[model samples]
Target chain A: MSPILTIIVILVGLYGLATSKNIIKSVFCVTIIESGLILLFLNLGNLEGGSIPILSGLVENIVDPIPQALMITTIVIGSTITALALMLCIKIFHHFGSIEWKEVLGREE
Target chain B: MNDFLAQIPIFLVFIPVVFSIIIYLFKAKWTTYLSFVSQVLLLIAFFAYLSFWRLHPGDHLLVFGGWSERIGISFFHDGLSLTFSFLAIFIFSVILMYLFKFRRKDHKFFFFFLFLEGIFLGMIQTNDLFNMFVFLELTTVLVTVLISYQKSGPSFQAGIYYLLLNTVGALFFLIGIVFLYNVFGTINIRVLQELIGTQGDRTVVKFAYVIMMSGISVKAALFPLFTWLPKAHGVAQSGISALLSGLVVKGALYVLIRMERFLFVEAGFHMNELFFWIGVVTAIVGVTFAISQKDMKQILAYHTVSQVGIMMMGISQIGLTPFYGGVLHIINHALFKSLLFLGAGILIKHYQTKKVYEIKGALKTFPIVAVMLIIAMLSISGAPLFNGFVSKSMIKYAVKGNFIKEALFFLINLGTVTSFIKFSSVLFGPKAILVKEKNPLQIISIIVLGLSCLGIGLFYQVIASSIFGITISTNLWEISHFLDYGLFLVIGFLFYRFVVKKDYLPFQKIRHFKLTFESANYMFVVYLLVVLGVVFL
Candidate 1:
């Protein structure tokens, strides 16, 4: 599909994030959004008949390896972010003894 | 000399990376020694950059891989890049020196700080766009954990928010990079510059500029995208706040500058107007929020928004294209801002309270800290002979090309002065004994920065023209100095009365901060998808 579709995915994901009360659910939505973007990037570099970007000595055309390389970096970075976010989630739960964003966000402080 | 300087610059970037990995095996004491050794080496590298600037003026160096430019990784160091890298490494070295005290019980913070410094240095020096992305991600991962280093509710929530915000911004950045790589066939900055120079302006080029700047503006925390900045900054530890506010946002600004010059040429100049206007709005609204803040660091956090406005305004105004003004202020802000935050860290460590009322009488308790803080206050407020004035005035005159822009920015300056005036009062007026100073290292750092601020103002022209490689005209110096001294006197009085004693709301620790893994995972995927689609389309 078009890039607009991916943007729509982001908007929906954000909508879920703003409205969702569970920290874990919000985190999951963020990852889903990230996955969609990665898929889009992979699609961007796609050739009509291309398989994965691994070494194939065939004469047929292959996808660009740069974006693929970048994707791995992005994925690793994304996972690290996910891990850190979860760690923070655990910390928040420990301090407040609750996962509901509304109850915590309600205070003016 | 030229050959050595150029080769050493590349080695500087690699040495730290190598050392960082090597130290991972036995990090407790080794990391501390490794960071110290690397930081000293980094400082020497900065000095080499200085010599190269003196030796070769207004020239950009592209360190290509042994292969041709397009296919190889290149290190692009320009007048702009060199200046930023120097400032970053200088501050980083100082931070590393102070890390000794912090290393007493924790290797985690120490290791992370060095890695953070190394990543920023690598990001600044690398001309390859893909390499930039790698360093950027490295920075993000390190900083996310830094935000949550202490692991409290507020820290955790802030960490989560920062991750969400930065990830989205980074994805936008990747999208921009993908678009550029598609259109130009190379992501190396020097190569891209040549390509854009040949074609000049096109729909694709303009589209790329907008997309890329959108991503950068997010990281710079400019205007609408700045919502996460204060929360993340306030929630972080004092040192982390300093680094984030003083340097990390600067990474984004540096990239935007490089992109503007290389990709859009003057096509991106229009963003200056937007940047200038939004800067004023951000300054006014941000400081308005600051005046309401009672939480000490949160107030400083909001002040970051205001300071960012001033720095951007320096660059956006006409006849200020070299943007020396913003660069200078960036250095000034990093010095004083970091100093203030570190001092605040000392207080919190002692008193265990961040509230304004609760943090009273710091002057009596920590006399040395009080003195250091006053110096920072003077520097931040653009007082005479301090660094803040030198660059701020350059911006003030630079933005005065028209009546409306002039008026808006003047009001911004007034608001900035007023907000700082308020902070200075709380800093010295409080007589309460909080934390006794345990770390002499932190205080020494504050003093070092304070001196640097004064030195920057005294040698403004030399810094702008000589070290920074900007060709400074006598007229710009004359006008800027006059304005600098003018704003100083007026604002100095404003600080002493009608502003300092005014009561304001302090933002305490955010309560019951929320975290839902499901939502976070979902948001992450969607944003990453946006990056992908942009590349594909």
Candidate 2:
């Protein structure tokens, strides 16, 4: 059920990416896609009533730490790419004085 | 030497990252010298390793962080990786040498330059699926940075579009990786291959295959997903354009090929036929668009799309010779295409214009560069006694006895020849005013590339056998072959004169068609779903 919801979130993100008029919204859409993917990945590693993944002591069960670690890297990459893209978006706005995709394309060189 | 051979894979990646940091920390003046020295060392390492591998002929796997191969990250170096690394390192050195003179005092440029090289090296070396994803993402970011470093109007737009599309595509890749891990409990490619080999087909595996392949197809610039390529390659500086078209885009395709080896066990698969038809369509569409373009850079950019199609067609076939031909074409295309882009860069700078019609008398004004461009153009168009002809004929030989495939190949060649004819017309008119003197470094770099093209054409068999362990029949002197080539040229010339010269209705329609980012994304999603449907249903 939660996995289906994550896919729904991804679908919504894709829709936003396709239809968003504003560039910033599209960047946000990209982040949303990343978030949904990360959620899906984390969901795969989850165990019901699992304890924290640590080396303290042997427990009955624990969440898989691999996906968690991988998600951390994925989150870092997503945030850094988003930040850089938004910086470029600001530069684009300054250059063309518009943030809408259609208007930005319409502006002549 | 044996111990050192084992360590080459690590040094291949490590030297570049270390030197990138070193160059970044030092003064701007030291950046060039440091980069130069590092590239030379990298080149020496690559050649020594390649020569050792040639003698040894075995796979070398380096386990990262001192872990076992079953669970730890591992970098696999084989003939395939070595071939691409050789191409990448050689092109990097040549471009760095050329840019040495034209480089401004920007330390960030050098930093990204070496960093990009390291990422590419690591990408080619790694056998871990998740590690490949990480490298792919890093490359996406670095390329975005390099493309937008100028911060111009078009560059910024191109950069953002590139970021959005690639990020979306890569996220899909991650999704595939997650699915694979969930099903198989491992992310290493070799282990997954062994598991799938024994376990046979499953619903989740096929789903993961289609999703990951769709994502990789975006990077490979396969037919519908190639919208961002032209904007990014055509907008940037020539050096970046050369790198993007020559190496960066091919990196994705390389990963696709690597994955195909492991995931899709041979026979009864749909992707083969799908890739073939896509290649045929991409060839026709790419050239049709190239002919409609008025800008020089845009023409070259579209032509890159077309050549990729040709390479795709070659590799898509089932036979060993065709596969060798395709691999060989990758290297051959890299050489001549980068040479053409760099040469076009020089012309654009000298004329202060990118318009094809405005540029005049390159042959008369810049005779040396003109000759060099002619060599590249000839090689690209597969003219006799050039590098293009050899690999093209190998591909032709590969698809022999299939009249439809042969005819399609001929049509692609004709399109290629006709477009380059239009491109080469700049060589024959009144001289442009106030041409700049040629830079010696640029000249040397181009000359080296040009000579390699000629040398490869002359000694193709030797190079082919040495690199790919296959010997091609170099029967260029046969009268029948000459007649066929002559027919191709005559028809190509006539087609250009009557059809493309007049700019007919269909051609005009192609010119007016533009795929916006929204439609492009939509196309990607549509294709992804379609491929999934085909694979699963």
CAPRI-wise, candidate 2 is: medium
Expressed as tens digits, the lDDT of each residue in B177-196 for candidate 2 is 99988887788887777787
lDDT of 1 by residue, B393-419 (tens): 666666556788777766666665666
**Tens-digit per-residue lDDT, A5-100, candidate 1:** 776775676667656667777777667667766766666776777666666576457678877777887788778778877877777777777777
DockQ metric for all predictions? 0.38, 0.72
Question: RMSD of each candidate?
Answer: 4.9, 1.9
Candidate 1 chain B minimal-lDDT segment of 10 residues? B504-513
Q: Top model by lDDT, which number?
A: 2
lDDT for each candidate structure: 0.70, 0.85
Model 2 stretches astray by more than 4 angstroms: A55-57, B1-4, B51-59, B266-270
Q: Given candidate 1, what's the lDDT at residue B470?
A: 64
Worst 10 residues of 2 chain B by lDDT: B261-270
